[model samples]
Each structure stands twice: as structure tokens, then as C-alpha cells.
Target: MVASVFSIYVRTVHRIWRQVKNSGMHVDVSHKRTGNCGRKRIQIDLTQFLEIPLRQWTTLDSLACSINMNKTTLFRRLKSGAIRRHSNAIKPILKEENKRSRFQFCISMLDESSIPQDPIFKGMYNIVHIDEKWFYMTKKI
Candidate 1:
């Protein structure tokens, strides 16, 4: 009756009853497990991780190989907030000459008449973009 009313297992109710009967006035029924209980979490050294090059950090498998750690363990660390995964896109390193050329190209695209008022690019109907790879593949030579 007590187990059904409390929505707890009969065995649990029996254990509590035993405790209360033994203690008479006071019954200490609290959780026994502490925060430190359970399997110890694997620790990751941030300094060592940071020392590895960006290229090695590209994939979890590569990183695991470099650090001598299991890929699954590394993945678990990532999921548990012990480590962070960053997706950094590779950007082209443009020189000053390249920058100047890009700027000149943008300047040429602007309408000359609109320079005095609101400057905007031309309709660009003359430009045709063709993939060099596709063009070369279709050619006989």
C-alpha cells in the first residue's frame, strides 16, 4: 500500500521501514553516492593539444593519432565539454599587388555616371564564367 501510494518499489519501502524501525526516532534516508562516484573522466591536456599544428587538428582521427589517444575517447571529451572543436576555413593569403588588382577590378565594375550620385556595379551581361576543368575535359586535344 505504501509502495503503491508513493510510487516506489516495494523493496525500497521495506528498506526504508527497516531503517526507521532500527533508528526509532530518526531515520537518515538520503542518497549515499557522492559527486566523486563513478568512473574517473579522462583528462585532456590543453597545452599539449594547442601545441599540435592546425592541420593535425582537422580530424578527430588525425588528432587522436598525433596525441596517442583513442578517437572515441577524444570524441567523448568533445561531447562532454572537456575539449572544443573548431571549424576554421582556409583563407587565401593575398599580397599587396593582389589586393590592389582586386580593388582595381571592383573600381572598373562601378558605373561611371553613378559616381557623382549613388555608385553601383554595371549589369555585367558581357561576362561569361566557364569552369576551366570542365572546358578542358570536353576538348579533344
Candidate 2:
């Protein structure tokens, strides 16, 4: 009657009814799949990987070639959290003149009157920060 009414297979209805009967009023219909059912994850030596120079770590193909491992496997390891990717930005080295200019700019911010008593910076209400990288002034002709 339940199979005909719900438009489901008789076997499925029987299985559900059997579960409810066995467990009393409440039925445990939760999924039985566990995390341990999958194939074991391949182990990687992180120390050996780190020993390779930072320059070689730029591309997965090059890094995998240097370590004698398949690129696909390396990528899988990266996705699985077994391996990490580090990106270090190359900062411009500041010269003595640049350092001096920065120091002078910092000094200029100090309140002249407060310097003698409690050295404090002036309330910088006029300062406006602009990212020049994406700020374009002209349209391409």
C-alpha cells in the first residue's frame, strides 16, 4: 500500500519498514559511509622538498621534474594539503637616500609645539591614499 501510494519500489518500502520495526518508533536512516573507506594517501618527505631552491618552486612541472615526481601527483598532493605553495614578493631594496627621505617625511609629521613636551604626530586629516598601479589618466589612442 505504501509502495503504491508513495510511487516507490516495494523493496525500498520493505527495507524502511523493517528498519523502523527493528529500531522501535525511531529509525536510524543516517549514511553509513566513513572517511577510512578510501585509498591511503601517498606520503611525501617535506624536508627533501624544502631543500630544493625557491626559484625551482615557481612552476609545478619544473618542481616535479627536479624531485623526479609526476606533475599530476604533485598537484594532487598540493590540493590534498600534503604540500604547500609559497609565494614571496620581490621588494625593491631601499638605498641610503631613500631611507633618509623616509626619515624626513616621518619627522615632518611630528607636531612642532608638542615636540618640546610630549612628541606627538599632527592629526593627518589631509592625507589621501591613492593606488597608482590601477589609476590610469589616459585612454589608449
In terms of lDDT, which candidate is strongest?
A: 1
lDDT, candidates in the order shown: 0.80, 0.78
Model 1 lDDT at residue 55: 62
User: Once superposed on the true structure, which residue ranges of model 1 sit more than 4 Å away at CA?
Assistant: 1-29, 90-141
Q: Tell me which residue pairs clash in candidate 2.
A: none
User: Candidate 2: how large is its RMSD?
Assistant: 12.8
Among residues 3 or more apart in sequence or in different chains, the pairs in candidate 1 whose N, CA or C atoms overlap within 3 Å are none
Report backbone clashes per prediction.
0, 0
Tens-digit lDDT track of model 1 for 1-141? 999998989999999989999889687887678776999877888888878876677678888988889999999988888887664433346779989999999999999999999999999999998766544332211
TM-score of each: 0.42, 0.38
